[model samples]
Target: MKQSRLPHRFGKERGRNKMDKFMDNPWFVRIVAMALALLLFLSIQDLGNKSEGSRPNGMESNEVETITAVPLEKYYDSENLVVTGMPDTIEVTIEGQRRFVEATKRQRDFTVYVDLSDLSIGNHRVPILYKDFSEKLKVKVEPVYVEVSIQEKVTQEFPVEPEFNNNILAEGFEAEQPIVEPNRVRITGGKETLEKISYVKASIDAKGLIEETIKRDTKVTVLDRDLNKLDVFVDPEYVTVTVPVNNPRKTVPIKIKQVGSPPDGTVIKRMEGDIEEVMIFGWTDNLQSVNEIEVEVDVSEVTKDVELDVPIKRPEGINKITPERVKVKIVTDKAKNAETNLSEVPIESKGLADSLDVEFLSPVDGAVSIKVVGNKDELKKAQEGDFEVFMNMQGLRVGDHEVNLEVKGPKDIKWELSTEKAKVRLKEKGTV
Candidate 1:
């Protein structure tokens, strides 16, 4: 019995020893601590994920957005009526679910407009309405109401004229009559406005203009008799205006030329041009060559004083000339012999070189006597001043020579020179 009791005691002690060894092992204790820590960390991470995944009850994600300058459409009777005083655009703000708000902002899926179809003529307040947006979005417009005025329609015809700033034109430049295509225009407006209409004109700016014809699409404006601008609708709002501009200008005398001789027994006593001078426009180079405007007159059958209308002949390179026609007066009388002798008809030496000096040797008084024969009436009006006698010394050397003299006078008159040739001597200007 004692031996069996001893063995039992030993076995109990061995078990006890084994339990202590396991509790005292550092690796085992470290492993148990690591496992417990991992479990606690996983539990906290799960709770965090759940909190992030779900939201509180009765809560949702929403966003707010704003859109600016949204255009407003108008619905009204535009044909027979005119509406005014309405905002062209407005601003809208929307607040809704995030997805819906983002979609609304991206697509801008909405409509803003004012409906005036049911409204009648005169002033009225109309509410600005909007539609076509998602139900989840809250829309707000900046201007909730708009004031509009409607007027009756009436039509009237008015002549269209062109207007521009004349002061802005270049110097020495002028504009001719401005031709507006579609000379007339129809204006539709209120009755009172139509009655106030005085003239319709298209305005253009002539600033810095260098073109010959100014062509542009211009807006038409209505004006009252007082020259104040009026508001009205004009059909065919624009018309083409052709303004001819030029810089060539000259004022010159008119010369009369005879086409046919006078009657057999009658002679032209005197021919005169009714218009003293005329204004002409052309290129600068062309204007420099034009000194006078000429017109031809026929006196073949005239036996008395007659007034004739002659068309002015336009020269090449000339654009326009004032006074399309000129009047000519021709006086005629019976042919008769009449002689007029003058003493002061100076003899001019022409074609002399600048370095040469010429002296007349034949005419002692430096003048010649010219005898002209014509009708008594014509000869009475003729004077020595009318005749010019010139001597040609174009190629003469520094020596004495005889130069022939040429006489100029009216075609109907006969002239006689006291001497056909004049004795002239050429010498160096400073030497003699």
Candidate 2:
């Protein structure tokens, strides 16, 4: 390389080096100078067309408007809203050119919703938010500072009643009075909404209620007087109605069943039992014809102590038992043979209610084989007049009945009678 004296440049080479440095700093030198020139020119010009003192871009001198917030009468509060009632739409006359008006009209109609929904229950003041507009623009409002009076919502409880349609109760069945478990419901809403509410109705789907006791869960529906459903709350979401229906009482004649057999050496002197009666209440078809009732006595392997336990029974058709267990005292003694006549004995009918008719069958006239165990002196002194057998037909209507004859004798004497089976026929007063 030729000797370079302190990096000296000349002619075309120097020009090329200078050009490269200028290109590197092109933005500052070119862009900045142009921007400054444009700014200076704009500053010198007036903001008006040459022909008139109006805006240069066909805009008015005053181009901005301020609109105030208008409150509303309601029980609710909201943050943002587009108000209604002034008109379906709002028209704005802008001072700007047609293009500006067209563009800003859409942008200018912005909403400043002062939510009354959340405000306190009393009157409140709220500010409206405006966007992209300067104080130069004038805002004309249909209604200003809308008198916003927020009323507090109220809650109330209403009773729900069942609505029955053409459904008829089943035959021999009647509609029971409808009783609601929780008759009332709580409704919470705005005061206006509460005022609009009319009544509450409980939905009763009788579609499945087939005439018997109808027990079901139903929903309580709040409705306006027009029967239109309303938005409300119920303290109890649902209510249950229990309807009790009554038909007729079914009577079943009770039958007596012997459970235990007497010991071999000792025989049953006289077996006696009263047929029990049971009245059942149920659906008509289920309780129609009750034939008899029977009771069961468990006397498994009972001997010597000789206490016989007997159970009275009603007809099998009757399912329920009025008297589950009745206490009966059975006496057992050594078998002895003695002849006794019914003539001298004071006939006794005990345990018979006043409404019964009694009759005597066997041992009424002739001598009966009286078997007993006691001191020889007591046996000798015992008279036929001291013993008696009577069958109760009192309160007994027309029917064929077999009653066990109860033998009444001196409590002090250890005597037993050997006749237990007695037959009696009873008829109604007028009937033969």
Candidate 3:
């Protein structure tokens, strides 16, 4: 048994020795290592070729980027034509290599504009254009085409009328005519649009206005006849509106006061104003205290007829006065007098109530005697026809009434009437 087990063990040992001999062969190990190295090299080469083939035509990987708020420029015959309906800005999306996209977004080295140079005076569809960008970039604008209206350019002058809300003025206060600086404006626009222009006005809000002049910068608007706003260009877009607001006004007579006596050789025959009265605006209290406006005239230096411009004295709290300065004529004649008496000067009645009539009862001829005194030359020029004596029968009842006779004559003469009171009877129309 021992000899047989020894052979089997020797056989197993022989088989193990054969496998060890095969594993220890250097040429086989060298072949296996070479195969593994060749497989790894092939794999690396394949990967490189695939990567190079993926990028065709020497192009690089691309990315998409969007740029916003890019201003749009226009090119056309702007001097002779006006263009409208063009957008101010647009957005552009670009697809290109990462480096170019980033550079384009950062540097903004591109231009977007519209070309209307070839368009005529009418509606036109113009294409948006772009240039001065990287050649590798593909750009797409948000709006590819723009609609524009081309019109013939024209210029016209329009008066600027000031407008305001009158209801906003303070109570008991009134506004004079508003004054606009640069009363007219030159407007340039389309010829068709200009034809429709009715008015150009400067609007001011009178809200919260009191007894003061309101001055403010107001925007100008162009409108049509129907008050519809029109699209136009104004050279002066704004104007200054000066609204003069004040209290109620009153017109009063200008009283001429003599400050000094006339020259020794000359006497002031008459002093009269060119304008009889002036309108003034002031507070209620101040107006109530004022009855008439007075201007003082100095006659000490006056020897002959003289014309002077006298400034009106304004009361405190008065806003304004019309005809601030009045022309006064001072008539002086030589100190020589002549008297003339005219008898039976015809008398008249005036300002009688429409429903009543008056009849003169005392003087049977309805006339009076008048005596005139003045310079010899002036007295020679005077006549009975120059005098008007009448009784104002205003507000009298239908009965006997005693009315004073009013007389008017030349400013340079002194006139005396025969009687101061007139006896008259008043009666209704139907009864009389």
Taking the tens digit of each residue's C-alpha lDDT, what string does model 2 give over 13-54? 888988888877968689878999998877667443444555
Off by over 4 Å in 2: 1-151, 164-168, 248-432
Off by over 4 Å in 1: 1-65, 190-199, 209-211, 223-232, 251-432
Q: 15 in model 3: Cα distance from truth in Å?
A: 51
Model 3: lDDT equals 0.86
Encode model 1's per-residue lDDT on 1-432: one tens digit a residue.
565456788999999999999989999999999999999999999999998668653277778788888998999888888776777788888987787888887898689999999988998998899999987677888888988877777898889988866666564466777778877888888766787887788887756745366777788888899988876778898887777776778898888888887865687778887788999877677889999877888887788889888889888877678888888888877777678787668889888999999887887666788888777766887877778899887888899898888988776677888888888888999995
Q: Model 3 — which ten-residue stretch has the worst lDDT?
A: 1-10
Q: What is the lDDT of residue 201 in candidate 2?
A: 76
Give TM per candidate.
0.44, 0.27, 0.44
State the TM-score for model 1.
Answer: 0.44
lDDT of 3 by residue, 167-231 (tens): 87765567889999999999998888899998788988855656677898999999999998877
Of 1 and 2, which scores higher on TM-score? Answer: 1
Best by lDDT: 3
